[model samples]
Every structure is written in C-alpha cells, then in structure tokens.
Target: MADPKGFMTTPREEWPRRPVEERVRDWDEVYVPGALLPIISKQADRCMDCGVPFCHDACPLGNLIPEWNDLVSREDWRAASDRLHATNNFPEFTGRLCPAPCEAGCVLAINQPAVTIKNVECAIADRAWAEGFASPRPPERLSGRTVAVIGSGPTGLAAAQQLTRAGHTVAVYERDDRLGGLMRYGIPEFKMEKRHLERRLGQMRAEGTKFRTSVAVGRDLRAAELRARYDAVVIATGATAWRELSVPGRELDGIHQAMEYLPLSNRVCEGDLAESPMSAAGKHVVIVGGGDTGADCLGTALRERAASVTQLDIYAQPGAERDEDIEPWPTYPKIYRLSAAHEEARDLETAPSADADARLFAASTLRFTGDGSGHVRSLHLVEVDQARLPVPGTGRTLPADLVLLALGFSGPDREDGLIDQLGVATEPRGTISRDAGFATNVPGVFAAGDAARGQSLIVWAIAEGRAVAAAVDHYLTGSSRLPCPISPHDRPMTV
Candidate 1:
C-alpha cells in the first residue's frame, strides 16, 4: 500500500492551471510546468487502494490504477511508468484528454473527493518521457505477418504500436498529409501540446511502425487491393460523421460544424496557416452543444479573442454534487463540473451576468437569423424542461456573429467506399458491425474504436485497439501474446 492511512491523512489536490489571464494569451498547455512534481506523492497517497478497485471496472482500458498510485507515492517513477504502460499505449493522451471515469469509481469518492488518479497518471507519463523511460521496444523476431491500420487517431496508433511490438509488419494509413489524425488537427494545442504526440510517434517509428499519410485507403488504393497486400486489416477510422441540428436558416454562411472550426485553429498552430480562416476573432460566437466539444469551442473562441461566447445545452442543468440515490457509488454520476475551458470562460467580461455561467442549460436553438448577406447574425432559442419540450415564455435571441455546432458525431465515414468495397456490415446505429472477436463480416478484416463503437473516449479506443490486435494476431498465427483489454461488446460504467 502507498500509505496505510494515506487516504485519511492526505487531502486531494489536483495540478493547478496557469492563471486565466496568462494561459489565454498563448497556446501552451494549461498547467504551470513542473507544478505537480512537488505535491504529486501526497496526492497519489490519497488512493485507498481498495481490495476490489472499482476504478478498474469503470475504465474501459482497465488501467492498473492502484499499482501506479503506489509506485508514484513511493517515488518510483520508472516503475510507475512501466506499470502504466503495461496496459495503456499512450497515458499522456489519456491523461490530458480522458474524463477519468476511474476517479468517479474511486472508493474514496463514495464520501470524499476521489483520488487524483488522472493527475498521477499524467505525472508518471511526463516523468517517463523526461527521464528517458519511454523508448522504442522493437520485437526480437518477426511474426511474418503484415497488417494495415486505417486512420491515425488513438485507436490506429495504439493498434499499430501493439502490432509492431508483437513483431508484425504494421502500416498505418491516414488521409491527412501528416500523422496523428485528431491528435494532429482535431484537438487544440492548449489542452495538450503537440510535442507529446511527436515524441510518441518518434518512438513508434524507431519500433518499425510504418506510417503512410495522405493515402486514402479506398481512393488512393482500393480496399480489395489493400486486403490482398496485407495478411490482415484493422479499420480504426473514427466516428467523424457529425450529428446535425436541422433548423431554419441552417445554411447561414457563418455556421459550421465543430470539427470544421476546431481543426482550422489547430492548423494555424501547426504552421500550415498564419491565421485560421474560421477564426472567431472579434465575433460573437455561440456554441450549440453542452459536452466537452462545446467547451472546447468556448475555450478556443475565448483564446481567439471572440467578442462574446455562449454555450447552449438542451438537457437540464446537472447538480453541483453527485446524487448517490440517482447514481450509486461505483457508477459514474452526471454531476456538474467546471472544465479548464469553463474556468477560462468564467472570467470573460462578456459573460451574460455577474452570477451566470457562459453555459445556458436546458436551452434549445429554434433557428438562426442571418444578415442581409446571408451570414448568421443572431441565434433564437428557448428554455426547456426535463422532457426537452420548450417552456413557454422563455424564448430569447442572442447576437451570434458565428455559430458552431459541437453536437457530437453520428458514426464512421462510409463515403470513402472502404466499407462498401469491403462488404462490411453496419449496426442500425451506423457503427461497423464486429463479431465477438472484433472481426468484421469480411474475412481477415477487423474493426475497432469509434469505427465500430461510435464516438467514445480515448481509453475505449486504446482498449479497442488492443483487443483488435489480439484478434488479428490470433487469426494470423492461431495463438497470440498480445493483451486483450475487453471484448467487442464490453461496456464500462462511463457516459
């Protein structure tokens, strides 16, 4: 155990972010660099180290939470990182991005604040890199099988790394000019710097994972030809077909999908452009959708110096604290929480009121009003109740020089002809159909991550990648050594 009475003695503390005024001025990571190194041990000690850790059950990747927590508390960073990497391929990505369902299931969270599992995990990963603990682990011998992974997101990266370390010849295909699908463009650099991604990709290259960017599998090369070239194929393409909000004046010029707007900002950071064409600068931006993506839009707009930012959600506002009666211990509760973006938004002078949040819960967009030139100028919305039926007498309009729909994704992209050409089947929900072993209907072709499971977290993507790698390894050699974190149908107690 980390500390016999550590949970009792220590108060939970998370890594502190840089001041809002300072952080909003630049695209650097939100944290004060090296801030956690001093206080992390005590935070790690807060783990109760439960006999039956529900943290494991809540994490789709089944991360070894207690082991790493203990190792961190002991200041055995190398060992802690090793234990972390044993199950996860990229703790850095998950550490920065994942919602940390494990903490929601923490035993201590039944009463007190949850153990700082996410912070500890991030510290370990950052330490591992700083100390040269994270390195290429090339296999000693070849497995004599070649596999192709489509997409360069977390799932494809994880599967490619696993297959490469397992001694299989792995080639990852991405449509973008550079690698790291969403990592390269979908995610903002302020949340996670690109250097972390570059570091891992460097390690993968040293370990013999071949990357082929700007090559569309179904267009640049047909799916059938790809199948013939490789012994097996894993489709790790993400659910990118974003859900739409069909309403009057949806065709306004200033309106765009969140993916469309966020990626451009990322490209500006990538030096592809000096400024984002879709920059929210000087605009009154209204983000529709109350999830993480909406918050992302909110933060990005604030950083871009938007005149104002407002986020709208159709669901009723969540409680500030967990309601155990509604969602018992060990299950992730939908409680109101402030994210870094929300924190930044709170300080904006343009906030609606002295006490009001930038977010408007239980609000539904009725339509948009466009300027004479057909650019959006205002958004019409109304408050709603639990049933989402709008409450009368609550209709309102707000200036919206720009509108971003962060409404989430629908399913995988089938327009590329990959699914059609491969003859793969899809579930009614539009996700690719996979068997118990993560295999698609087509022989020797498997699917994983959001491609098969719909839009989900990075943890699930890594788990899906690992599971699919195992199935591919078995299909190629009748038996395999790769670890399978979960079955195709497995579900974690996460949203």
Candidate 2:
C-alpha cells in the first residue's frame, strides 16, 4: 500500500459527474473526463491487501484486485494494467459495465466503506491505453486446429481472443451487421462510449481473430454444415428473448418492450438512424421495471425531451442500507441505489419547471387504456402487496402516451433456428442445458454466457466464455491449457 494509514487520512472519493442540467441535453458519458486520476491512487491505498483476498471470491472473473490495487497505489500503471488483464480479456469493458462485486467482498467493507476497486480499475485501464501499454498479443506458433465461436458479445469475443493467442485458428460469428453484440447496440453511448469498444476490436483483429458479421450459423448455414467445417464450436449467443407483460392492451400502439426502445435510441446515437421509431419526444412516458434496463429507458426518454416520465416497480422499495440478515459481509447487498438517471430525475423534481420525474414502488399494472385510434392514452395500475399481488380499492389511472416494458429477458430467442436444428436440450428456464464442462448433449458443441446461464453480468459472460473455451480446447485436443475460471456446477456466492 502507498500509505499504511491512508484509509484513516483520506475518505473515499468517486469520480465527479457533469451537472445534471448539462448532461441531460446530450448523449455523452456523465462522468467528468480525467476526474479520477488525482483521487484513484489515494483510493487504491485504502485496500488492506487482506490475507485471503475475499474480493477474488466475489468476482466471477476472479480478478486480481489487491495486486492491482497495490500496483495502482505505487503508480505502476503499466504493471497494474498487465495484472488487471492477466485474467480478464477486456478490463475496459468490465471496468465500465460491471457492477463491481469485488468491492462488495473487500475485507475493509466489513466495517467501513469498501476500497474503490472499480474506480482504480477503470483508472488503470484508461492510463494503460493512454500510455500504449495495451496491445495485441499474437501467438508464437500456429496450431493446426481450428475453432468457430458463435456470437460477438463479451463471451464470444473473449473466447476467440484466448483461442487465437493459444495458436488455434478462431473465427467469431455475429448475427448483427457489426461485432460487439449487445456492447455495440443494446448499451447506450452515455454509459460507455463506443470508442472503447472499437479500440478493443482493433486489438483483437491484430491478434489474429477473424470476425464474420451478419452470418447467422443456424439460419444461413445448417448446424451440421458448421460442425463439419470447424473442428469445434462454441456458442456464446446471449439471451435475447424479452419477457412480456401479458396484461390487457398489451398490443397497444404506444406500448413497446425495453429491448425495442433501447436499441433504436442507441442506433440513433450511432447516426445509423435519423430518428428512433419509438422516440419519447413530447410524450408522457411510463417505464415498467425497476432494473438497470428501466433506468436506461428513463435516461434515454429524458434525453429525448419527454414531457414527463414515471417508473414503476412491483417490488417494495429497498432499504437505504444493507440488511444484515439478507446480505452479509463480503456479499453483494440489496439496497436502494441512485443511478445517474435517478439523480437527474431528483434534480429535475426540485427545479422550477412544472414537469418532473416520478417513481412508484409496490405497484402493478392492471392494463392499458387506449384511444379509439389504437394509440395508448393512459395506464391502469393498482397498489400491490408484498408478493406483488394487487390490493383492492387502490386502482388508479395515469395518462401515458408511451409505455416501455423493461421486465427483463426470459431466455435466448428460439427463433434463431440453430436451437431448433441442433436439437440441444433446454432447461425449464428456457436456457440451453449443458453439463459440467459446458458441453451440450450434442458432441463437439458447447454453449456459454447468457445463452446457457440466462441473463447475467458481462464479467460472468466472459468467465463462461473462457471456461467453455477450455472445455472445447480439451475436446478438440487431448489436453488443454486455457484458464477455466468457473465450471457449470459452480454458482457465484453473491448470486
């Protein structure tokens, strides 16, 4: 550590964000650029570098948190980046997108605030890129074996990069027109700029990973044909089937799913579309769901200049502090959080303007009331009990020109044709079923990430990718050397 008593001397300081009024008008990232460089080192010093490092146990990727924290505190950014990337294929992505369970598991967090592991991590990665420490790592020798990875999300990309560096020919397939799967389209630019993704894709290309976009495996080519062409196959196709609200007026014109609304806004930001078909401009928007996706919709709708916004959740409002009985030390807690969007909403509510954002908890949607033209006019809701069952005599109607269903996903889209043709077994949850090695019932084929594990964090997806690559490598060759972070039988302690 840089200072033995640093924790006592300095309190935790996070990166500063742009003022709410200023950031709400554009799609740029909310955090102020270069704001963390000054404070992150001091924050890194707060790490105790515990004897057992429970932070590692908290992370599904098993990131070397303490080592990098020490390295950052010492101002050895180059070394810190190396340590950070040793296990993770894309620290930049995880650094921005991950919820940072490692911080929750920090030994210091048992008493005081957790060490700023996530901030230090993002700082180290940004410094590495600025100093040119991050570059392609090509293999020394070529192996005769070849592998096909389906999907361009974090899992597929990580698997392809690892296999390429292992001297095996690797080709990644994506159904979308571009690589980066959800990273490229589902995520908005305000959360993470696209430049970070582009630079990583460049490095992967330099490292001998081939990408094939817009060529779906089970649709354009038969699964049998793909199996015959490649020595082994790894499927990292993420879960894309959005869960629907089966209430009355589900087919109303202004009612749409979160996936449908989010991607359109993202594409508009990328200049691919002149305008989003589901634009929330000059409308009263109500988003149903209390998850990150709902928050994303809240932000995007605000940016689109919605007249008013309201978010509803079936669950009761979480406590401000962690509940000791439900979530113990070194485990992720269930507590109320104020995301950037929510912060903006609070600021707007206190403004002089008449329009303000609203949020309702323990609420359930009864149905939609539409005008004669089939356009949504209002939403019918009722107060819900602890189990989200509707309570009597609490029914109300609120005007709503647009309604976004952010209820999250069910599983992978079976319409992909690959699931049907391959005849792979699926669990009751609708995700592909795999054995301990991540291999499906069909031989020489493997599945990973959301496609196999259901919807989850990017870190878990990457871990699944690396682990599945090892299993596939072992299947193709008698022995393997790829690092397997987690097996199919292993579930995250925090989960």
Q: Write the per-residue lDDT of candidate 1 for residues 1-495, one digit (tens) a residue.
A: 868899899888889999999999999999999898899999998887889999999998889999999999999999999999999999999999999999999999989999999999999999999999998999999988999999999999999999999999999999999888877888889999999999999999999999999998888889999999999999999999899999999999999999999999998888999999999999999999999888888888988999989899888878888887888878888888888888888876655731246888889999999988999999999989888898999998989999999999889988888999999999998999999999999999999999899898888999999889999999999999899999988886733
For model 1 the local lDDT of residue 78 reads 92
Against the reference, the lDDT scores of all candidates come to 0.91, 0.87
TM-score computed on alpha carbons, candidate 1: 0.98
Tens-digit per-residue lDDT, 257-371, candidate 2: 8888988998898899998989999998889998888888988988998887888888878887777788887778977788888888777762122122457888889999899
TM-scores for candidates 1 onward, in order: 0.98, 0.97
Off by over 4 Å in 1: 353-356
Which 10 residues in a row give candidate 1 its minimum summed lDDT? 348-357
Which residue pairs clash within candidate 1?
Answer: none
